[model samples]
Target: MARKRLLLAALAGVCVWGQAVPDSPGPAVGARVPGFDLADQTGQSRNLHSLFGPKGLMLVFFRSADW
Candidate 1:
């Protein structure tokens, strides 16, 4: 039982360490992002500035796909 508890504790520590932590207050409100590039669903390169229109752009982030 003690060995099982120790293993579980170690596993928990590993899981916590594997997670990501933000280093700074990334992109404050109303702050202009210095521009970035990412691939679209069609696998084409897209730029942040190009996406903005007269109405501007709305960025949405999903924490997990399981939800």
Candidate 2:
């Protein structure tokens, strides 16, 4: 009886954990960026529009230096 109760409690906890939490939507593909200002390596503020090339900007991300 106690073991069955423990199993049911764990199952209930897992069901609660499996629920999806609400989150705010992020930028979608082909969507125009609203533009932002960020500091460069030299600590100077730069605008995203100013960095655009003839072919347009392509943002790149790095997971980590150790990886």
Q: Candidate 1 — which residues are off by over 4 angstroms? A: 1-25, 64-67
List, residue by residue over 1-67, the lDDT tens digit for candidate 1.
9767866867776688865544333686578777789998899999998799899998766687586
lDDT for every model?
Answer: 0.75, 0.72
Residues 1-67 of candidate 2: C-alpha lDDT, one tens digit per residue: 9767866867776688865533323565567768789988889998998888999888765576585
The residue pairs in collision within model 2 are: none
Number of clashes recorded per candidate: 0, 0
Q: How close is candidate 1 to the true structure, as a TM-score?
A: 0.50
